[model samples]
Target: MWIKSARIVDPGQQLDFTGNIHIEKGKIKAVEKASSPMPGTMHEEVIDARGLWVFPGIIDMHAHLREPGYEYKEDVYTGSLAAAAGGVTTVVCMANTEPINDNPSVTKYILDKAEEAGLVRILPAGAVTKGQEGKVLSEMGLMKKAGIVAVSDDGKPVEDTSIMRRALEYAATFGLLLISHCEDRRLSEAGVMNEGALSSELGLPGIPSAAEEVMVARDTIISSYTSCPVHITHVSTQGSLEIIRNAKAKGIKVSCDVTPHHLLLDETRLYDYDTNAKMYPPLRTGADRKALLQGLASGVIDVIASDHAPHARDEKDLDFDVAPFGAIGLQTLLPAVLRLHFDYGLGLMQVLSLVTVNPARLLGIDGGTLKPGSRADITIVDPSTNWTLSEDMIMSKSKNSPFLGETFRGEVVYTICNGQIVYRKNGI
Candidate 1:
C-alpha cells in the first residue's frame, strides 16, 4: 500500500511535513518527502491523503475489553473494532474482565480471542491478585511467560500494603511494570463523587482527594524501597500530581498518566447529577485540572490513556447514585484531545506525544515511530475538519460517552495497521 501527499506527523523526531509512506508485508518500507507520485508498482494499493495529517497509530495503555464472561458490555472483537475506528492501532487490555485475567490460562484465552477477531493489537495485563481478591498474589512468573505485558488491579486497588510490596518485588525480577489504581478503599467507602462544594450541594457521599493522594504516596514509598518500575494510573488530584513529581525528582523509577476527561472536565459537571460524569477517582476541582495540564506540559506526566471502561445501557441507565463509574472513550479520544491542542493553544506535537511515542515507550513497544523499519501502523487525521460527536455514530457497543453532541475540530480520515486498511472515512 502507498500513502501519498500526506502531512506526516512523527512524534519520535518532532517532525511534520508532506511526505509519502510505503507499506508492504506488514512493515513500513519507506517514508520520504515527495514532489509527485511515483510510477505505479504491480499489485499495490494507493491512498491519496492530499490534505490530511498522518500520524503514528494512537496507542491506549489502559483499556478494558470485557470477554470470557461479560460480553454484554463489550467483547474483544467489538472493543478492538471501536479502537480501530478511533485510529488506535494498539491497546493494552486491563485485568478486570468477568473471570479476571489472573493466571496464564486466562491470559492465553483472551489472546486467542483477540487473534480470531483480528481488528487491533491486544496486549492483556494480568491481575495483581488471584480473582482480584486483594488477598493472595497471582502467578506473576507464569503470566509473564505467557506474554502478559504488565500486572494491574484496575477496578480495585490492592489494599494490602504487604501484598502489594511483594508483587512489586516479584514483578521487578521479571522486568514487568506494576501499574496501580491508587485509591484507599477504606477512605473511599460508599463515596459517590468528588468530595467538595459540588458533592455538598448535591448531598452525595464524598470521596476526598486525600483518598487518592494517600495511596499514591504509599505506592511511591514502596516503589522507592523495592526499586521497581511503578506507574500510577488515572491520577486525578493536585496532591497526587505533586507526589509523582516529587518522586520523579527524587529519582524513583516512577511514571504516571492522565485521562482526557480529567484534563478537560471537572467535578462541577456533576451538579446536574449526570451519570456520564461519574467515574473512579472522580472528576476533581478546577484547581486540580489546571495542575494536571501543567504537569503534562512540563513533562511530569509521561502519557495519556483513555481508560476506556465500557458499561451496558442497563448498567448506566440507573440513578446517578447507583450507576457504574466509567465512560467509553476509544471512539472520541482523538477528536476530543485535538480540541485541547489545536483550539486551546496546546502545541500539536506535544498533544500527539501524549498518545503516540509516550505510550509506546511506557509499554516497551516498537510501533509508535515512523522509522522505515517500523511496523506499518499509521493514522491520517484532518485537524481542521469540524464535526459533532453523536452517540449513534460511535462503534463501541456501549453509549456512555460524555462528549455526545459536542462539536469537535478534528476527525480521523484513514487508519492503516499492519499494512492493511482497517478504517477509512466514507467519501473522504
Candidate 2:
C-alpha cells in the first residue's frame, strides 16, 4: 500500500513534507519524500492523498469505554467505532465499569472484548484500589501481567493521601503509570456548573475551581515526596496549571492533560441548563480558558485528550443539575483540535504533538508514530472541509455532545489501523 503525495506530518520524526509511505505486513516499510520515489512495480492499493493532511493516527490517552457494565451508555465495540471515525487508532480506556477493573480477570475481559471487535487498539487501565473503594490496594503486578498499560481509579479519586502514596509506589514496582483524577468530593459537593456569577444567576450549585486545584496540589506534592510519577487527567483550572508548572520546574515527576471541552467552552454556555456542558472538573471562566491556551504554549500541558465520556440521550435530556456530568467527544476531538491550529494560532507541530508524540512517549505506547517498523496506523484529513456537527454523524451509541450544531473547518476523511481502512467518510 502506498499513500502518495500527501502532506505527511509525523511528529515522531519531526517530519512535515509532501511524502509517500509504503506499508507491508501491517508495518510501515519506508517513508519517501516526494523527491525520493519508491520503485513502483506492483498492483496494490495506492491512496492519492493529494491536498490532504496525513498524520500519525491520533491517540487518546484517556477515555471511558463502558464495558462489562454500562453498555447502555457505551461498550468496547461502539467506542472503537467512534474512535476510528475520530482518527484515533489507539485509546486507553478508564477502569470504571460495573465490576471495576481492579483485578486481572476484569482487565483481561476488557482486552478480550477489544480483540474481538478488532477495529482499534484498546488498552485498559486497572483500578488503583480494590473495587475502587480507596481502602485496599489492587494487585498491580498481576494486572500489569494481564495487559493493563496503567493503573487508575478513573473518575474516582483515591481520596486517602496515604493510599495514593502507596498506589504510586506499588505502580512503580511494575513500571505502570499512575493516572490521578484529582478531585476533592467535599470541596465540589453537590455542585454541577463552574462556580461564579453564572451559577448565581441560574440558581444552580457551583463547583469551585479550588475543588480541582487543591487536589492537584496534593497529588503533585505526594508525587514529589514519593518520587513516583503521577499523571493528572482532565485539568481545568488556572491554579492547577500553575501548580503543575511549578512542580515540573522543581523537577517533580508529574504530568497533566486538559480536555477539549474544558479548553473550548466556559460557564457562559451553561446558563440554559444544557446537560451536554456538564462534566467533572466542569468548564471554568474565560480567564481560565485563556490560561489553558497559554499553558499549552508554556509546555505545562503535556496532553490534549477528549476524555470521551458518553451518556445516553435520555440521561442527557434531564435537567442540568439532575443529569450526568459528561458529554460524548470522540468524534469531535480532531475538529476541536484543528481550532487550536487555525483559530488560536498555535504551530501545527506543537498542537499535534500534544495528541501524538507526547502522549505516546508518556504512556510508552507503540501507535503514535509513523516511523519505519512502527504499526501502519494513519489518519488522512481534509483541513479545508467545512461542515457542522450533527447527531447522525456521531458513531457513539449515545448522542450527547456539546459540539453538536457547531461548525468546523476540518474532517477526517480516512482512518487506517494496522494497514486496514477502518473508516472512510461518505463520498470520499
Candidate 3:
C-alpha cells in the first residue's frame, strides 16, 4: 500500500510535510518525499491523497465498549467500527462492562472478542477492584499477564486511600498504569449535574467541583508516595487542572486527559435538559472550561479522549436527574475538537498531539507515528471539509451524542489500519 501526495503530520517528532508513505506486510516501510517514487514499485496499490492530511491514527485512551454483559449498549465489533469511522485506530476500553473486567478470564474474553472483530486495536483496561466494588483489589498480576494494558475503576472512584495506595504500589512493580476516575463519592453521590447557578435555576441536584478536585489531589499525592504512574481520566474542574499542573511540575508521574465536551461545551448547554451533556465529572462552568483550554495548550493536560460512553436511547431519554452520565463520542470527537482548534486559534500540531502521540505515550504503545517500521495505522482528514453532525450518520449502535446537529469544518476521508483500508469517503 502506498499513500501518495499526502501532507503528513508525524506528531512523534513534531514533523509535518507532504510525503508518500509506503507500507508492506502491515508495517510502514518508508516515508519519502512525494517526488521520489521507488524505481521498481509496480505492485503497490497507490492511493492519491492530495489535499488531505495524514497523521498517525487517533487513539482514545478512554472508551467504553460494553461487552460480555452489556451488549445492549455496544459490543466490541460495533464499537470498533464506530472507532474506525472516527479515525481512531486504537482504543483503550474501560472496565465497566456488565460483569466488570476484573479477572484474567474476563479480560481474555474481551481481548479475544476484539481480535475476532478485527476492525481496530482494542486494549482492555482491567478493573482495579474485583467487580469494581472498591473494597478488595483484583488479581492485578494475573490480569496484566492476560494482556490488560492498564487498571481502572472508571464508573466509580476507589475511595479507600489504603486500598488505592496498595493497588498503586503493586501496579508499579509490573509497570502498569493506574487510571482513576477522580471523584469523591461522598461529595458526588446522587448528584445529577454540575453544581452551579445553572443547576440551581433548573432545580437539579448538583455535583460540586470538589468531587473531582479532591480525588485528583489525593491520587497525585498518593502517586508521589508510591512513585508510580497515575492518570486522571476526564478531568473537568479548574482546581483539578491546577493540581495536575503542580503535580507534573513537582515531577510526580501523573497525567490527565480532557474530553472534547469539556473543551468545547460548558454547563450552560444543559439549560435545555439535554441528558447527553450530563456526564460524570459533569460539564463545568465557563471559567473551568477556560482553564481546561489553557491546560491543553500549556501541556499540563497530556491527551484528548472521547470518553466514548455509549448508552441506549432508553437509558438517555430519562428526566435529566435520572439519566445516566455520558454520551457517545467516537464519531464526534474529531469535528468538535477541530472546531475549537481552528476557530479558536489553537495550533494544529498541538490539537493533533492531544489525540495522537500523546495518547500512544499514555498507553505505552508504538502507534501515533509515521516513522518507518511502525505499524501503518493512519487517518487521512480534510481539514477544510464542512458538514453538520447528525446522529443518524454515526456508525455506533447508540445514537447518543452531545454534538449532534452542529455544523463542523473537518471530516475524515480515509482510515488505514495495519495497511488495510477500513474506511474511505465516496468521492474523496
Candidate 4:
C-alpha cells in the first residue's frame, strides 16, 4: 500500500512533513518527503491523502474491553472495531472484565481473542491485586509471562498505602509499569458527579477533587520512595496535576494520561442528570478543565487515553444515582481530542503526541512511529471534515458516550493496522 502526500506527524522521530509512506508485508518500508523523487515501483493499493494528516496510529493506554464476561456491554471484537474506527491502532485494555484479568489463563484468553479478531493491537493489563481485592498481590510474574503490558486495578484504587507500596516494590522488581486509578473511595463514596456548587445546584451527590488528588499524592510518594515509575490514569483535577508536576520536578519517575471527556467536558453538563456524562473521577470545574488543557500543552500530562469504559444501554439509561460510572470513548477519541488544537491553541504535533508516541512510550510498546521497518500502524485523518457525532456512529456494543450529537472538526478517514486497512471512512 502506498499512502501518498500526507502531512506526517510522528513525534517519536520529531518529524512533521508532507510525505509518502510505503507499506509492504505489514511493515513500514520507507518514508519519503513529498518533494523527493518518486520511487519506480508497482503499487497494488494507493491512498491519496492530500490535505490530510497522517499520524502514527493512536495508542490508548487506558480502555475497558469488557470481554470474557461482559459481552453484553462490549466484547473484544466489537471494542477493537470501535477503536479502529477512531484511529487507535493499539489499545491497552484494563483488567476489569467479568472474570478479571488477574491470572495467566484469563490474560491468555484475552490475547487469544484479540489475535483471532486481528484488528488493532490489544494488550491486556493484569490486575494488581488478586481478584482486584486489594488485599493480596496478584501473580505478577505469571501474568507477565502471559503477555500483560502493565499491571493495574483500574476500576478501583488500592485503598491501603501498605498494599500499594508493596505493589510498587513488586512492580519495580518485575520491571512492569504500575498504573493507578487514583481515587480515594471514602471521599468519592456515594458521589455521582463532581463535588461543588454545581452538584448542590443540581441536587446530586458529589465526588470531591481531593478524592483523586489524595491518591495521586500517595502513589507519587510511594513511587518516589521505591524509585519506580507509576502511571496515573484518567487524571481530571488540577490538584492532581500539581502533585504529578511536583513529583516529576523532584526527579520521580511518574507519568499520567488525561481522558477526552475530562479535557472537553465540564461538570455543568451533569445538570441534566445525563448518566452518560457520569464517570469515575467525574468531570470537574471549568478551572480544572483549563488546567488539564494547559497540562496537555505544557507537557505535564504525558498521554491522551480514551478511558473507553463501555456499558449496556439499559445500565446507563437509569437515574443518575444508580447508573454506572463510565462513557464509551473509543469511537469518539480522535475528534474530541482534535478540539485541543482547534479551540485551545495547541499545535497539531503536540496534540498528536498525547495520543501517539507518548502513550506508546509509557506502555512500553513498539508503536507510534513511521520509521522504516516499524509495524505499519497508521491513521489518516481529514482535519477539515466537519462532522457531527450521532448514536448510529458508535461502533462499540454500547452507546454510552455524552459526546453524541456534538460536532467536531476532524475525522479519521482511514485506520491501518499491521499494513491492512482495518477501517476506512466513507469507503475511501
TM-score quality measure for candidate 3: 0.98
| Poorly placed runs, candidate 2 (over 4 Å) | none
- Worst 10-residue stretch by lDDT in candidate 3? 35-44
- Colliding residue pairs in candidate 4: none
For all predictions, the C-alpha RMSD in Å is: 1.3, 0.9, 1.2, 1.1
Model 2's C-alpha root-mean-square deviation from the true structure amounts to 0.9
lDDT of 2: 0.91
| Each model's lDDT | 0.88, 0.91, 0.88, 0.91
Stretches of candidate 4 off by over 4 Å are: none
Which regions of candidate 3 deviate over 4 angstroms?
Answer: 38-40
Lowest summed lDDT window (length 10), candidate 1: 34-43
lDDT of each residue in 267-297, candidate 4, tens digit only: 9888788899999989999999999988987
Tell me the tens digit of each residue's lDDT in model 1 across 20-105: 98887889888888775576597898888888889988888999888878888899999988988899988899999878999999
If ranked by TM-score, best first, what sequence of candidates would result? 2, 4, 3, 1
Q: Write out the backbone clash pairs for model 2.
A: none
